[model samples]
Target: MKVKDGIIGLLIGDALGVPVEFERREYLKEHPVSDMMGYGTYNMPPGTWSDDTSMTIATMASIINKKSIDYNDIISEFCEWYENDAYCQYGLFDIGNTTQLALINYINGNPALECGPDDERSNGNGSLMRILPLAYIKDIDYETVENVSALTHGHKRSKISCVLYIEIAKSMIENDNLDIDGHIKIACDKIINYYKDDKELIHFKRIFENDLDDIDKISSKGYVISTFESVIYCLKNTDSYKDAVLSAVNLGRDTDTVAAICGGLAGIYYGFDSIPIDWIDTIPKIDKVLSLCEKYEAFCDEY
Candidate 1:
């Protein structure tokens, strides 16, 4: 599994599902995105991606140019990109209310750390969705990844959730002999340690550590913890890249974003070859994503 291909697969999946993101299951059943041939509600031509891909690309671009995860740089790039309508189709759709509010606060002179909600309820999946680039950077220790997460997402629970997902993805990519159960146990332990006092963390632990077999039973809706857990569930249960994403996309709410996140990790685990070629061919930014991957791979080589 070349890491480049894994990244490419992620971009492809994100773009392919963007147009049909929130359509009901019945709607999809009638017009299933069975192939990456790219037909969906947005009525976009086959390759347009939503905020998922744009933010990820922004993250990747920051790492490539800065050679590290600089929070200020990422925010600047994100705002600049959004303002310039770089993500044209996605801008037409509503940005998350929390994100909009947070960005507004940031723009109005609030400290970046203080921009997001102080309450536990501010746990949207925005942070997790844009963190995949950290999974690709090289030589920087796990401490760097954790620090970067905290910088972008001030909430400890949100930071920890991003850390866990990155750790799982890194283990899969670097350790051929990685044990999934062992990885999950380690992640769960670390998450518990970080948010031991929080009730949401307790609830997350109960749902995550249980013997729940249904992927759909796991909530992939919108909360950071739930979305992270759902992605983990999809990764653990599915046998192939196709099954992993299909399972995630079929789960009613927040389907596209969940599938994109799961698809990115699964692509890394299963390798790019495991992803369908048709899907790769259909991504809107195929050339651009591949270029970034190549540049990232070169950067990894240097380190």
Candidate 2:
């Protein structure tokens, strides 16, 4: 029941903020988004979702159809699903250059491992944004999360960030006996153990542990590092769904993705009850998402 609620909460928060994403904080102050029924924006209407939910639904669809993570197959599914206008109401499908290049390369027959660029710069939050479904599916197993992340984003940074994020959600969902500090410690210890020798991972861990005071100083850009930081910030500071998402959305850059990622973690921590009922009720495609949840529940029965 918690898993079902968590997934729904994620989509609800993602869809709720679609219209206000990237709008200046001043504008939101003057015209607050107090509900999800609708918000008229320059280009889209209220209740529209962005790539966050689109890719999430694609991930869920792949799991339902294939019954397991297939790297190449999921990539193909994402491309076909996006191109076919499956989630067209989300506005322009302007995907990131790295993801677009990797997809194009895969279509031209490049090996999945070789599709992504060798440069570390390609490690963006794009990988993490589409990965919440995996958290609920694997029940937060570190090895399983790492394997799923490597399927599309094989870079070391991408893989580590993905693993850590899902582990956070997993710890929250599975550890009824533990408190928040215990969960954070367990997840951080696992991450440190996994990449103890890797400099980037070490730097990231150090930043997470010792740099609470400088969170605003840390970049909130679209990179994986920034997204990870933002998630930690939202988790540590906010007490409710509204505070968590509103704080993330106001963090200046990459607002939607940050809110989506933060909202997923916060949803797991606070449970579905923390989310506003009115927002959840009005989210677009609520019935379809509920159907997908039912399918996932059936699949879990077999496992």
| Candidate 2 Cα misplacement greater than 4 A, ranges | 24-34, 37-42, 87-94, 139-144, 150-152
lDDT of 1: 0.67
True-structure RMSD, every candidate: 3.0, 2.7
Please give the range of 10 consecutive residues that has the lowest summed lDDT in model 1.
86-95
Question: Residue pairs in steric clash, candidate 1?
Answer: none
For residue 162, give model 2's deviation from the true position in Å: 0.2
Instruction: Score each candidate by Cα lDDT.
Output: 0.67, 0.70
Top of the candidates by lDDT: 2
- TM-score for each model: 0.85, 0.88
Per-residue lDDT tens digits for candidate 1, residues 53-120, read 77777777877788766766766666655567663443545356566666666677776556655456
| Candidate 2 lDDT tens digits, 129-208 | 87888767644466666555554566778878888777777788877787655677788888888777877776486445
| Model 1 segments more than 4 A misplaced | 25-32, 37-39, 87-94, 139-153, 190-200, 207-210
